[model samples]
Target: MKAGREKARGAWQLSLPLMLMITAASVGPGVARADAQDLPIPCANFEITYAAKPGEVIAPTDIETNKDSFWVFENSGGNLACGGTGPFTCAGLTVTVPEKDVVHPSTAKTTINGTAAALGEQDQFSLTSIDANDVTQTCKGTYLFHVSSNGGGWGDPHLTTVDGLHYDFQSAGEFTALRDDRLEIQTRQTAVPTAKIPITNEHTGIKHCVAVYTALATRVGSSRVTLQPNPNVEESRKGMELRVNGKLVTLTDSGITLKASSGEQGASIGPAAVGGIDGHIKKAADGAIEIVDARGTQVVVTPQFWNGPNVWYLNLKVYQTSATQGTMGIVPEGSWIPALPDGSSLGPKPESIDERYEQLYEKFADAWRVTDATSLFDYASGTNTATFTLDEWPYNSPESCDVPGQTPVQPTTEAVAQAACAAVQDPKEKADCVFDVMITGHEGFGKSYQIMQAFKPIGTGTWYSPEARPTKPPTHQGGWVELLKKWWWLILLLIVGLLLLLRKKK
Candidate 1:
């Protein structure tokens, strides 16, 4: 209405002589008087053109883009222009979103006055110039989201990632676990400093700190779900509370379901059934919540009990599409901007644990850390990420120790840990559990590692045949040796044949 009134008001401002001149000129070949204003406005049909610039660089086909913001449609160039360049204007440029698109401003009616506004798998829209006599111009386009196919977990008390990369992030704060165009996961870690109780590691003397997730939140489309510790703290420790979009939700025998709007459901949450919500869900063995979005993105928010700290911290297992882009997702393949001091690429993978730690913990970790503007986790009335983010690690190295409130870790020897973790099925996990148990000096934590080993991810979410990445690294040991051992007789026959040939020649 404002744009129409502005155009009408301008049309009336025309002088009598000028109006007459326009009318006389309009009698020519094809020009016409347009509009129902007090005075006729001379113009022709309004025209619109599409441009990718001044907005997201759309995919070659205008379907895939990795952004959480809406797409922008530029119109200052030609959209709603009368006579191609006439003094015509339009406003209240609205867009029609398909139900499949769970876009922000998740409303049916969306307005994008040219240089602003966009959404979803596909959109159909129509708008007219401000002139009351102008015809409505219709437009339509399709967009399919691209996603990341790889995801991994951030283990409590023990930092781990998909790259088989591990480190100790002993900082208490919320960090962006994963984020993509359509999904996001965030974690709240609590740091445990070794300044209380007896030394946990008798061998190392225990001076370092470790962090663990205490709260986890995820956003798929517009449905935000959070699993955090129950406020009612007890010596026995109550389980976690699940909230959807800030409203506390309870789990039924069949679990809970949430949607972006009143349309088709956007996500389904349920208990860890024998088969999992039709295999779309991946429930944690410890009864953590498993969520599946329409796009088949899987998220498992789990809590682990830390006997050493006598606290329960959370962990995250994310299986995003190829479109995933956060630190926990399939990030860039070890490409660091500031080259090594000698000016060389960091190679495709880290060569050593220190190199990997520097890349993941220092460089890549900082790259994806959330700021106030981009953070998706809901904060309490008076707190934020900054409130929790501090010098979480203040103690010096164990080389020289000053004891304070170090938590007591159960004593466990290497043999004991191996035997405890022997029940774990996966050899890799068994080794890892044994290693971790030795480090923490507690056999109980072996259960945590066992659960970690069994963390079944929703591999390549929804991908019937995913793109081929590098093959798995060669096994720690084996390859030809095992094959040869199984075929010793065959080898012996070849050796005997060679000896017979040599004897015949002699």
Candidate 2:
């Protein structure tokens, strides 16, 4: 029995391919009808001419010809594309004759009256209304009709009804119906700053939720709501609220809670949160209180309105209690705001940010005058008597330190020493100027030798001078060339000779 069954199955399989071949041969060659192969293309027909003035309707001449001879009548059922017999199908009926070339006419003459005075493809339209299914409201106005295709599928001439609503799309074969509401209400779906609390509030120490609202319009109701901190000041907090269908309702306190009414009926569990309600019904996580009416159910007593701040105490108990409203429930909370930018914990303060600017300025000026960096040293009275010298170390941008008669230039060491010696009457002051300029300007230029020969004598008060010179010599160690070149060389030699006698005896 098994061998026989296998043999029978193999025979059936062999016959399958032959059956398909027989069917194809019977169909015949080139039997496809032109009408079947080329289906009827849907075309839109409308009055293309319009009145020059507004609020006026213009009639157009008949477009009957070989091209528009056959047309499937339009009805509530939709455009019918049935006629002729062949592989090429004809849908919505089309004119076999070609349309007149209106753009680039042979001559500029007015032959057809009210038949598109302007030269172009049909650029005019006729007004009509769409009343069927979910589209009930009577649409009143002119509809601009055009034909478009998405390559894979071809659509009939579509009529665009120009209603005021921007969000609603008015076209044929659309899943969504055109809304009758004003465009402002349809497209103006802003967040409105009022919604449920944010989901992250629980983690940030916010224990409460609050909401407030104020209705602005009648049919087009508008409201403002707010969420605020609850009574628990020690804990962190966050909150938000929302408005539905022009109805104001805010969530506050412990945040939002959701619960299901029945098992298997479907439900959700999540935190109470706030976000933009772009014209849709919102409900509690447990499937309660949809802000948007997607179920098409009538709602009695829209959710409570809230604006400003409110507090809420959220928990399992609150979720169960809120389910009774058939929608979401809300509460009001409040919080404190700051009066100024800085805290006053430090006590009453001065009027300005910097109260000691004036005192600081005075101290800076006094210190600058007393301590002069320019001048020369003197030995008399073992003190320096010289003013600051800029000659030896002139100002880089001399204009910075140049007085009325001073020229801007780099100061020579000799000029600086001379200026230092001339400025102060005290030998020590003069020496200090030379030392300061040399160290600061020349990177210790001749400073060591100047200090040993000039400053050391004045500092010890051993070598005295009858009068301090207007300028002082270099405070560094005296060199042989310098001693031979100036009168100071003879004095130095005498002092050395006198000290030799004492040294020999020792």
Candidate 3:
């Protein structure tokens, strides 16, 4: 390869501009750029060190609010590229609207100020990479930035709804997370015993507690799947509880097609078959089952194991086209979304959590609570959604220290818990991680946050950017893509030689 490149160096006098464009289609900035520099060229291996998935992004932050340089660098790979290095030369960037529906462009009028270009068009906003793990480059494909910035809190339950509304409602019940005309998501929230987890500040004399989601159900284009906990099963058991339509099914690998099981046919829920949902009943490599409907509703449920039983927590990362109505859709205390019962809007957000509680719990939580008609859960012969609701529930979570007249208290092992969550980067996530560890005295909870940071957040179009890009660090990629990159100059040399041979024959 070195000899070939050395040989091509002499022929470099030809059209070099077109060559770079032909070979620049790669993932991220780690791949060093190629260029013809001074005298005899020294040996250089151009490999993609950092590669972000096609439309992968995390932060919904825009160029203006974020003063960060190099907002988004889109390149028509194969048309031209190269920025992670090699003589760094290229054409320009193109902004693509990921899909239909969902607002376009993150900001009202995106006017990028950096050397990078201003966001040209809309549907999908061009914004900064939210996730710290994303590798910025001038040639990586389109970065995700929902104008309404759709995705929000799977925050273990400190809900951040559609329009970025933040609040908490820990009522133990099966509630609607999201409900559109066709797409639907339901979560089973179970209150944690104060004795089990100490979310209340140390012995502050308040029976403070919180709830975590134990199961999640989704109906996407004629498919209904429930991810729930396997009760009475030992912790050693390693598998997910997946109920397709109404009957339970065991999965060995990723994808599965559901057929009418005994008693599932003609049941209350729709038909018993998995109707062409992409990745239906498919288990992700990380032990989570991911399901997506044709019309852009997506659900990824990660299994959680702790003191009680091995339950699961789900995160919905979509803002549908239709009027989304449910817990996840309602933006409480914020004027962004039409949250009021009368089809009006909630004004600016209040400062304190208690103030939010007064609004979120009273208005949205109760308003969106699932009824017998709207309820989508499997019930025992004698029980129903009422089993989860409180006979006389309070305004705010009783476990919250934010309750008026009650002073907040920190756990006795605050230091230890903080230390456990020290590795988590995001401030809010870190704080939550520390508290979870301190309250439960279980380090596993905090570790989960650390693991999630690596996940490429799901964005518009219900398309997922694979969390791990290179799978193996930019090590020796033996595939043809790498082969071409390594011997590109050699290939060019042969082409030039062939051209010369044709000219001589002529």
Cα lDDT of model 3 by residue, 121-225, tens digit:
111222222212244423222222122234334433656565545545555667777755345788877654433434433211222366577777776545577
What is candidate 1's local distance difference test score? Answer: 0.44
Query: Worst lDDT window (10 residues) for model 1?
Result: 32-41
Q: lDDT, candidate 2, residue 32?
A: 11
Off by over 4 Å in 1: 1-148, 154-170, 194-208, 261-285, 331-366, 392-411, 452-506
Q: Candidate 1, residues 30-67: lDDT per residue as tens digits?
A: 21111111111112212112221122332211122112
Model 3: weakest 10-residue lDDT segment is 34-43
Please list the residue runs of candidate 3 whose C-alpha ends up more than 4 Å from where it truly belongs after superposition: 1-156, 195-208, 231-240, 257-279, 308-323, 330-342, 346-358, 392-412, 457-506
Q: Which candidate would rank higher by lDDT, 1 or 2?
A: 1
Candidate 2: RMSD to truth:
47.7
Best by TM-score: 3
